[model samples]
Target: MKGYVHSVESFSTLDGPGIRSVVFLQGCPLRCQYCHNPDTWQMNEGNLVDSAEVIARVLKNKNYIARNGGVTISGGEPTAQIDFLAELLKGFKEAGLHTAVDTSGYVDLDDIDRIIDDTDLFIVDIKHMDPEKCRELTGRSNEKVLALLGHLENLHQAVWIRNVLLPGFTDTEKHISDLCAYVQKLQNVQNFEVLPYHALAKAKYQDLDLPYKLDGISEFDSKQLLQYQDMIQKYYSKKFSIQHDAWM
Candidate 1:
């Protein structure tokens, strides 16, 4: 199977456990206002290549990934091209590497089922808890996101929940509380991370000729992130550490 690939990170310690090879695929459904990789929005823009070709490249750097780390197929919403993603995941498994998919979770269960078995972990992004608020920020409803999360729960799939802390939108007390409440419902969550927002994508938006909706927003103070752990403990009890150290 073939798919459009935006880029590749040969050694990324922040994308997942240990060191990993990150396959940045092209295409995303949600137009997240604070998105950093706006270049990946167009489905057909990136270089098209077969799954085997991508796998071969990743395996070439396999020794760099060592034992714990493996492969992560990230996106512009990787699930946007389910068949291609499934093929890549299947290849990773056949090669005896741990597999993971970093997704927005705005996907159909049927589509997710294609790669679910092969994926060792799911790095899910939960943008907003309120459907209307989610729509306002992402230009899409959170219904599909929640549905996909629920499906993963049923399968007892390993999940790492991620939420970007946008200053005015997602950093409010109510917003965080609502997110914590929802996360409490799931018993299979391995980690819950609140990513501090960064406006490093300003130039990218300007270059792409797209309006930067989060124009004046400043980067979040990551040091203050520890306070959220106490808030999360009120509703759920599990790991609540910062997982996006790569951005730092």
Candidate 2:
């Protein structure tokens, strides 16, 4: 089967463990306000390639991936194209490569189940904890996202929770505490990442002629990010008995 692919990054260090070959799949249901790859929103506007072709491309740099690193399917929400993603993950797994998916966790549970067995890691982005605020930021409710997390937990899937710290929007003590509390209950959560918000995607919005929702919002400085990370680590350590290094 052919997958609509936006692009590929051969060597990505931050996507998962060690280094990885990141596949940027096309199409996303959520219109996240801070999305940098706005061009990947359209399902039909990408290079259609068979799973073999994509796998071949990744294998070209197999040595670089080594054991700790492998392949990651990102998007435009990779699970939006479930069949193709499943096929791609199967191919990666068969090749002895660690597979990871970077998703918003807004996909249907069935779609996720189709590829979960083949996936090694899930980098889930939790936009916002509050349902209304989640809708405001991502143009979708958090119900499906939360449900996806629950499903993954039920299956005992390994997951890395990623939260974007948007100042004045999602970076409040109430929000962080609530999120930490909820995450602490998930037994399958392997890591927690607090990503600082940035305006790097504003130019992309301008290029795509799309209205930038967070136009005036300023990016958080290093100090703010460090503080948030410290707070989150402290909460996780104290409440869940998971060390900061274990999840970070």
Candidate 1 residue lDDT tens string, 1-248 = 78999999899877778889999999999999878899999999899999999999999988878498999889899999888999999999999899989999888899988888899999999999999999999999899999999999999999988888878898778988888889978988888777778888889988989999987777755466666556666666666765445431
Q: Ten residues in a row with the worst lDDT in model 2?
A: 239-248
- Model 1: residue 213 alpha-carbon error in angstroms: 0.4
lDDT of 2 by residue, 138-164 (tens): 899899889989888988999988887
Error of 2 at 33 (Å): 0.5
- Indicate the worst ten consecutive residues by lDDT in candidate 1: 239-248
TM-score of each model, in listed order: 0.94, 0.93
RMSD of each: 1.7, 3.3
Model 2, C-alpha of 190: deviation from truth (Å): 1.1
**Per-structure clash totals for the candidates:** 0, 0
